[model samples]
Target: MKSGVHRKLLNYFLGEDKTMKKFTLSLAFLLLCLSYLPLWAGDYRAAYEKNDFKTAFALAKPLADKGDPEAQHMLSGLYKVGWGVIKDYQLARKWMTKAASQGHKEAQSSLG
Candidate 1:
């Protein structure tokens, strides 16, 4: 009877150990994703305000490529108005269309 109880206790401890390992692994993965997600720029706003549209354009392009509607809209505006970039209406229309197709209201307004 004592040996049977010891076996049950051992199984319970083993189960808890497995559960703890799983929990730790899941937490680590979550941390990794949160730290790395949407890795873009350090200070896009500062770059824009400093008239460093070149850097703003650089930082926003990757986010725009990833389908971020706000980034797409800004990139479209940059292309449309020649804001630190050569005016290119075709590129502007392309990005505006992309944002509008995603249901971005501002992008639709800009396209019109």
Candidate 2:
């Protein structure tokens, strides 16, 4: 009778161990995929397209500050249109010029 109880406990523990391992592996895989997400400047374009201006501005500002020309161009428009931020044409032109200097075609044409 004692041996049967021991066997049951052993099986229970083994089953729990397997479940724990699967959970850990799934969590790890999810984190790995999240870590591999691209940091492209245009990544925030979806937010802008959705008219989620606050989210777009929040995402673009950091990339623009980090010297991303595409982000600079987008940020320029955000400033010009007062989307999720105060209107400031001077700031818009400043950011546009920065993007244009980096060979952003749209910014260059807009500047002209």
Most accurate candidate by TM-score = 2
- lDDT tens readout by residue for model 1, 35-92: 8754534455568779888888888888789888877887898899888789999999
Candidate 2 per-residue C-alpha lDDT over 7-109 given as tens digits, one digit per residue, 9 for 90 to 100: 7668666785566677778999998887776644465899999999898999999989988899999999999999989999999999999999999999999
How does each model score on TM-score?
0.62, 0.66
What lDDT does each candidate get?
A: 0.82, 0.89
Model 2: number of clashes?
Answer: 0
- Point out where model 1 deviates above 4 Å: 1-33, 36-42
Candidate 2 local Cα displacement, residue 41, angstroms: 5.0
**Residue-pair clashes per candidate, as listed?**
0, 0
Model 2 weakest lDDT span, ten residues long:
34-43
